[model samples]
Target: MIQTLKLHSLKWLCIALYLPFSLAAATLVGTPRGWRNIDWLDVFGEGGGALMVLAWTLLILGSRPAGTVSNLIFAGLGLIFVSLWQDNIDEFWIIPDAQLWDTWLENVPMPIGVVILTLGLIRWYQEQRILMAQLSKRERFRREHRSVDPVTRLASADYLEQQLDVELRAARRDQAPVSLLLLDVDGFDRINRRHGVAEGDRLLQALTDLLLLNLRDGDLMCRYGGDRFAIMLPHTNETMAVIMAGELTAAVSHFAYHTHYEGERVRLTASVGLALALSDSPRALMQRADHALADAKQKGAGSHASAA
Candidate 1:
């Protein structure tokens, strides 16, 4: 968590420096308003707003990775917080009429902040759309965290079967084709024996990321079991599924995974099986994919087979 926060140090450092300077400016050039002249209502309201804005800025920086959307949102929130802080301070400090800095501080940032915030939100909407597309597969399983595998963060076998049933029904109703691909890491047990289980787990996680990057937006990838993954491709036919399976096989073969401990390059390969939905049951589809996967494994590493 500390390391993650450090990734957003730019925003935090800015806030830290800005706060002291704003306070020092308020103290140096302005006289403290007497208790009788101070507006308590403005102090409470503007002070609360500034606090809330600061909270929001911290929340955004903490939750999101450092990227374009995060940077924009952080900047906008920072500016808004600064403006509100100045406004709140103005209630307690009486600046000379000749001094325009206080007015500039209170007025300049708010509208600029709002414009930047609007642009950030628009980009955020687009980003969410892509993520939702990627997540649509897992969403079919009711979003149970327990159903997610700890290693790959993909749906577990039981959850995959449940979602397969849902997709099977949808396919039957719409008369659309659905395909399943089963991929198993070749020589994974050898990797574990040679490099340790921790390294093996790292390999699985890295392979999961690679597969996800290669899959289509709507495809659902799941951890069927150890060293085995299943993918559900809705509205895809046998030929397209076979092609995708081959692509996955090639991708895994090309991936150069390195051991975390030794930094030794671990070359990898995978066998893939593709089966189109013929029956309206998840069991039938999975069984065929499994059979095809077994055939691919028998053929050799980096091989793929489609169910007849």
Candidate 2:
């Protein structure tokens, strides 16, 4: 522990090495009096710069689902924030001329921030490449705009129908089996009434992600209605599809959402209905799944059933 203590002490010592510069800056700012001839342009540039850096920091921290990009942006912004903060303080602090400390604070982070930002951009490029590859592996980013539900930004019923048609045709042509899954959140309307619209919207998005997570890459998922989702699968038989549907129901049942009003967490569950297509349109396949889902709901609200 002695050695570790010494190492940490040294690290902090290095940081303290910059304090003289900070103190000197504070001194300079206190006495820029009667120095109107001093570089006013520099003052304006640095002042505006300080504000911009602060804004960048806030924007980076405020972004949702922040990933590697956010971290990189934060670090870059932090460097700028520190530099500008020091510069702005120096505008009035009257540090002694011989100290040369104020100059160090003003100039150091410029190079450091640029170097760090460059490295971050390099890594960001690599990350984008990996993401693009993953996206291409499953989806062409095909403007499945028709398939997506506009309200929740999830897959739409029409898109589901189109997908079912495509998958069914492909299956029939290859003599492969296809399955359709229909899932509806249990007591969703009651939850909407109790929790308000925002919470209801949150639940729908959460459930969409959960259901999509349980599907294979070859599956096509779409939002069927207000609280219902459908998935179309190729090369899947009834037993296998039913097993997946059961897993989906279980997955959704375990999802607990934290409500804003009471700050209390409540679990949301879904009842599922599955169907297998036998040379049919997307609508027919979905109809079968919907009927089966209705059956599951009638029997019990937290389970799954199927129709062929």
Candidate 3:
């Protein structure tokens, strides 16, 4: 609370000073109305409105951070409060008709305040919508937390298996094709031995990002296990899957990653294996891709093999 007050001290000061100024201005320019002449109903309504506006302003200042929207809201409410306060003062003090400034003060601010308040409300609505979208994205990630790999920040092998099962079922129903690409970083264990484990982890993280950039929108990638990644492509045949595998291997070979401490430029290559599903369970399909990967590794770095 103290921090909030400190942050909005200027706004609070303006409000504090405005109250006394309004009171003094009216008292100086007008004569006090007689007890019989004072309208109690107008006093209650206008005074109550001013107090409510003041309370709203305080709440806004307390809860919201100092920003453009908060300032706009404060300004609008301040004007409304000033107008109501002036109107309430009229019940006690009778200003002559010639004192047009008093009339202007009582009447002018209300409409301008309404306009400003409307704009503030619109902006507030837009702000809330953006906040809600980000919250929704975070909620989705939270629900999928168990299916996420901590190292690469990609989906895990378990997530890949689950999604592959769903896609295989859909493929059978629609008589469409689905393919899988299994990629292994060439000699990843050698890199881990040469550099530190931290550097190897960093490389994997960077590689994950690189591979994602190379993937089509509908494709899904997962960290299948250590030094290996899986890509699931829907509505694709063996030929297109093999083509994509080549592109992915080329992307990895061209990527130059520098170590953190030494800044040593390290070139990398990946071997890719392709498999197209055909009356096979998720486990059987993955096994075929694994066999293809083994064949690619035997052929050497940056090689592509297909078991479709």
Per-model TM-score versus the true fold: 0.72, 0.56, 0.57
lDDT of 2 by residue, 222-302 (tens): 677888877777889888998898898889878877887797786777888988875887777778788898899998888
The backbone clash count of each candidate, in order, is: 0, 18, 0
Best by TM-score: 1
The regions of model 1 sitting more than 4 angstroms off are 7-10, 29-44, 63-71, 94-99, 125-166, 209-217, 238-308
Which one wins by TM-score: 1 or 3? 1
Q: How many backbone clashes does candidate 3 have?
A: 0
lDDT score of residue 242 within candidate 1: 82
Score candidate 2 by TM-score against the native. 0.56
Quick one: best lDDT, which candidate? 1
lDDT tens string, model 1, 1-308? Answer: 46667899877888999989988988999999989998889988999999999888777777788899998898788888889999998898888867798888889999999999989999999998788777765454367888889988888888778878888888888888889999999999999999999889999999988988888767788999999999999889877888899899999989988888789999899999888883468988899999999999899989999887
lDDT tens digits, residue span 92-115, model 3 = 998899999889989999999988
Which regions of candidate 2 deviate over 4 angstroms? Answer: 1-141
User: In model 3, how large is the Cα lDDT of residue 105?
Assistant: 84
Cα-based lDDT for every prediction: 0.87, 0.71, 0.86
Greater-TM-score candidate between 1 and 2: 1
